[model samples]
Target: MGSHIGGDELAVSNPTRAAQEISQTIFSLDLGGISTVILNGYDAIKECLYHQSEVFADRPSLPLFQKMTKMGGLLNCKYGSGWIEHRKLALNSFRYFGNGEKMFQRISEECMFFCDAIDMHKGKPFNPKHLVTNAVSNVTNLIIFGQRFTYDDRDFQHMIEIFSENVELAASAWAFLYNAFPWLEYLPFGKHQRLFRNATKVYDFLLQIIERFTQGRVQYSPRHYIDAYLDEMEQIANDKAASFSRENLIFSVGELIIAGTETTTNTLRWAMLYLALYPSIQEKVHREIDSVLNGRAPTMEDKQRMPYVEAVLHEVLRFCNIVPLGIFRATSQDAVVRGYTIPRGTMVITNLYSVHFDEKYWREPAVFCPERFLDNNGNFVRRDAFVPFSVGRRHCLGEQLARMEMFLFFTTLFQRFHLQFPQGSVPSLRSKLGMTLQPLPYSICAIRRQR
Candidate 1:
């Protein structure tokens, strides 16, 4: 398997394409001597990741993650009682600050700022990367730090830059080698070294913020994630076996910020690019916004009435296939999946790209068609194969929050601006792979609409 499919192939190429070449939905490859199973297609993925979730609930201890995190955070932690406790607390905290009227209001407020920042371009062609990232980061900031940073804040901007760099580097060839060979870190130079340095800088920055909150935080009265976590730590102080610790807190907060910000930011960026590439679709979205919103701010309630907009967003997620190979999972116990026996501790890779593009489930899967998500009457219809967030336990923790942010941010932008390519500049749909599948740098003009 290793001879036929090397680490470089897995690192650079789409897993779905590799699966197609091999003509197997469930196949195993020896990744640097580590036994790894690739689950492709919707049915195969559904049976294992959805039905037998617990069997594949544990995260594989990649050398890269183990060195950076020491397996202490929610994302890379081993599945056990401690992880369960932390996940529950995180979910509860998300519910407390990330739901209902308050959550909508917070995202809506950020949406205005996002539009204002874009409006500064004055309809000229500009790269929307930083502005979009800042906008999305601010929403996550509100939940984690209880405040939002200004778009021009240098420190916040630096933090975001480093975070984005780390995301891309983590999926680089060097990072893959480092993961396969744990001892590569001892080398004098490599991208892995820079990865470590950037990680330390981010940790230092987060630690500073956590220290600031510690100064004024009151016990049992929480204002944000850090406060709530500190409160939990105090409660579990005497419990020797509990997993809540200062290190875990920092790692978890970092995870939340990255997970919450990067995927949604990139998704919105893709949405903008797609709209520019396809003007007819953009016109239809404008018509829906004009008919339903009429220059008014959009709320979550408005999503139900605007099927076309909803369909567009859904199609963006499906077509783009962000996070194609979701965070790798490990088998918690020996399990039989699709008549094959996967031993305990084997690494499991869920090919979300395959699920989204599964021919058995979608018609003309390669085409960029939003109407596929709508029925004959034009109402949005949910498809079973759409699993951008994955399925069952250990799926994206920020799924709900991401959905809200995407809807509010997406609708708000199209509601106010006419997004299109600059004159004589052709839009490119090509994507650069990293931790997520990001659209290659493209410029779009956001002309304000006459309401």
Candidate 2:
């Protein structure tokens, strides 16, 4: 039996009912401002949820997510025809900005810098949070502004820290208050107000960059995302149908930076935890890397050859809950599921953790088994349950970039060194729950593997 989402009081009273089939009990009242929609035993079914996106495609009314997002800045935004227009342009923006070419090049270079920065902490258990955060943010910087920063760059690093701090508030108590009564933000002692101020700073920073980058030739001439967006704004200069203003461009780019950065960085951090905890698994991955390319850094093409290595990456994302409960989605219109008709504006969430760990779909779902991704024929076929990036129209825009960054950053570091938890400190699997369920912070030494 599964529980259904109702109003706030019902949710608060019936939260354990929402925990359903999960072994790790959820603290009631929705930490991140939406209750978990437990799927129970129905997860593997094709329409495990019906009217899923149709009944629930609106972004939740959380002031924290909404304000930070600037009301559906991109991914977690409400589902509407407006989304179609925005997503199409956003997808085009990815290409126009040379997302696959110059962007990937910047990603590779910045990721290499990440590896190098980690390499600097050689033989010392290092807290990689800030360096990794900066490294991840730089790829977005490259895409949005054609700029990349060293891990130690003060200006970018400060932006990264502030952004991280502000987003983390999404899972805090005040986030719920802000969502329930957005007016609370203006009240004294409200941290949400401070976050709004910081968000304004970030927005201003983006505006400044847009003001700087848009200088020179016709807006669309360069064919970059900003250029193209600016060109559209010029065409629709007076049209109400146009959301193609310079602020939109800045916010969209800023959205990419915020959404894209911490996730890949956190996943890398979790991968490190997995490596330290399971040295043999680490050895096997390194061995695969060694055998396939002989000390060369991994590439997307190399994934076809290194099956085990690919599986390791999958397992890392599966086990690491970077986006817990996935991004909130609400019903755009009334729709029925299992004979129950959820009304319009009904908020919905997919069971991201459940989908990853459902027993029917996985063998030893609780264990870190990379072999699950490989079939008897040993082909790395995509699993239906791999919805870490979400699915369908609302899928992540930075997925390809994330995959590429993870592969390069991860494989490069493994090529140069092996990591170990500090002396007498055991690797902890106990996750510190956050907006993403992060593994508790711990340091590890990257001892260079002798060639």
Candidate 3:
């Protein structure tokens, strides 16, 4: 059931195929000394990650991750008090700034700019990747820096390009090998080299911003994450062993910008692809928006009234299954899932693709049917198996902000324009894998809607 992928590795690219290869839901691969346990079903994943959260909450510090983050960031840090404190601080900051009316206003303001950029396409086919990325990154930028960048800003664009390139490279098998074998770093050339180069550039870029924020008397009223962090660091300066160090700030901001930009931006791109693929679905969503607000810009309040639109978004998140293999987690202590023993420090991969497409949990899991999320009464029904963001104490911290961006940007674009495959050209829903499952670059015509 476990076949060698190549060179001392056993692999499972497709969850359903992997399940067929091995009858059990929980199976392990001995990648040399590294043990990777794949949790392939919904029940098994929930049992370990959701139920035994503390036991399986730690992120494994692989070689590549160690080199990239140095265990300073919130996402890939080992499970301990330091991780907890960093996560708590980040959560508090996000809640303080990313909640209630102001949050939606900020998102909507960016959404307007996004719609305007799309309108400039003027019904011609064009790649929406940069436009979407720019808008999404701006939302996060505003939250993290108390400022936004112009779309034409050269420095900002280069930084984002490098961040995305590194993510794609890091997600490759080469990077996995780099993590498995640390000596690869000593070699003169490889994708790892390029990844390291890009990472340095991105970090240096971030460091410059950090220096600007930390320079001189900190008399500011804590404008953003940096300023707020400075205030916190100053308050805790008396403690020499504080977790809020300068290194953590750089890594934390890098992780926030990289993750925050990638996930929501890619999700919106998927939304665009799906809308173009299914014209009827697009029409229904447009109808719902038109009926709900009558041409007024969509607000968070309007989301509740538009069940079909909500259903579309839910389906998009579930269907796309962006983070197919959710971020790797490791067992902090010995743990058991579905009667299988998972030793301490074993690499744990929650197959989110399987959960989202599990036949037992979803009907016609392969089909792009928003109706699956809609009840017979036409009310939006939530499913427990929809774990695109994964579940547990360590799930995506930006879930609220991500959801806001998707809804605001998604509906606003559809409200103003109809996205369609250009002329007679057809685009596939096939995705290119990376740190995130990104839709292959495609073009769509955004014809303005006469509402």
Candidate 4:
């Protein structure tokens, strides 16, 4: 009975319903000769992903996953010393460049460009989608390649479009089937082929940047992530066991760009949507920003004084639930989670949608209430179950950078303009699932505020 129900649940796209149908916290499915387990409930998820983190820290060998990530990349690599070494190297590099004053200044400048673009809408109803995407992706570009592109750059736009297209294809039902049955790859005529083609384009684009840096025509001062990685490779050049190979470098750059861009872009887009839908809440957030900054530019330090703004952002992440299914994981060995024995090499999926919207963890999960994240003194409160970035050892490496971008971009935008849906059109909270849960294509009007 558990197996049948679990199989049905896995077949569906809506994770919330799948969690509801399963009576047990952990449900196992025989997915095309692979043993897969779906973990629901906060406690069950915590145990599998957290308490027994090592037992479930590897990447699954799915066909679509292999094509999309190659499992050679930092994001989808198998659990082992190679993954650990690269992860640590990437984290240190991020730390070296991530929180520097120069980085923050760049983000602020990008936000200015973003606000300028929105202001171009002339108070008329226009879709802020591409504008936001350009600005958000520019920040990632700066981090990865130490450069930003003009919004009108056709090559850059095409690359982003390809990246976006691949993300949507990843969420399609075809991706699910391909992952389950690897034999589908040879049959031809499916999105799986397009995914590989796009992957090649993305890798080629990334490699050009690396080749430029390595060709010695450009001075290398270890300016950004790519340069820093090259420095590491030089230092360990003689070490045969070093994981800092050219292949890892290429994929690591891909990981940083893809991971950093889409999720942050989607979250900021959702921020505008929610603020537009709830004018009262929007006003409250605006008041907080206005009071704290006093018309000056926002700094990370100002985050403490603006509790309501922080709460609203947190609420947005919770409400949006971007990356609902999250990155898939595989077991390192046989493990017992919540009294269930999940075998070795099994695919493990922690149903984040179930945990985020579970009534047991939240008071009113469906309602967009930022107050739930605030305490009696109206201060921000952190909830353990608020795992938008996922939990445990294999959590998102970009968590800190993402938070910085979201808070800074969000506050700056709201500080400059009042976001609302276009005239005569209702704000639709509909989301189209992809690599992330993106807000459906919608137009929003940003009315500039008077200082």
Please give, for residues 1-451, the per-residue lDDT of candidate 3 as tens digits: 2432332222345544443333226767876468889887688788888899999899886888889888776788889887997888788878887777877788888888888888888899999999999999998887788778889999989999998898799888889888778899999899999999888898899989777755653544766788877777788889876778788888899889988899888888998898888889988998899999897888888878989988998898888888888889999999866556778998888878768777778877778999998999999999988888888989999998898888889888888998888788888767888979999989889999885
Summarize candidate 2's per-residue lDDT along 237-336 as a digit string, tens digits: 8888655656566667777787878789889889988888899999998888899888665666786898887888898898675775767666566655
Q: In model 2, where do residues sit more than 4 Å from their true spots?
A: 1-55, 65-72, 98-104
What ranges in model 3 sit over 4 Å off? 1-24, 213-220
Q: Lowest-lDDT window of 10 residues in candidate 4?
A: 15-24
State in Å the error of residue 416, model 3.
Answer: 0.3
* lDDT of every model, 2 decimals: 0.88, 0.69, 0.83, 0.82
For candidate 1, the per-residue lDDT at 1 reads: 25
Across 1-451, the per-residue lDDT of candidate 4 in tens digits comes to 1553546546476655555455236777776676788887777788778898888899888877776666776888899988998888778767877778998999999989889888888899887778888998888888677778888888788888888888899878888888888788897689887887888998898778688755543344777777777777788889997778787888888777778889999999898888898999999998899988989999999988888988898888887888877788999998876556777888888778777777777886778999998999999999887888988779988798888889899999989998887778976778988879999888888888998
Candidate 3 lDDT trough over 10 residues, lowest sum: 1-10
Better model by lDDT: candidate 2 vs candidate 3: 3
User: Per-residue CA lDDT of candidate 1, range 168-267, in tens?
Assistant: 9999999988978878889989999999999999999988988986778889999988899988999989999999999999999999988988899999
What is the full ranking by lDDT, best candidate first? 1, 3, 4, 2
Which of the numbered candidates is closest to the native, going by highest TM-score? 1
Clashes of each: 0, 6, 0, 0
Query: All candidates: CA RMSD in angstroms?
Result: 2.2, 4.3, 2.7, 2.5
TM-scores, all candidates, are: 0.96, 0.87, 0.94, 0.94
Task: Report the lDDT of model 3 for residue 12.
Answer: 42
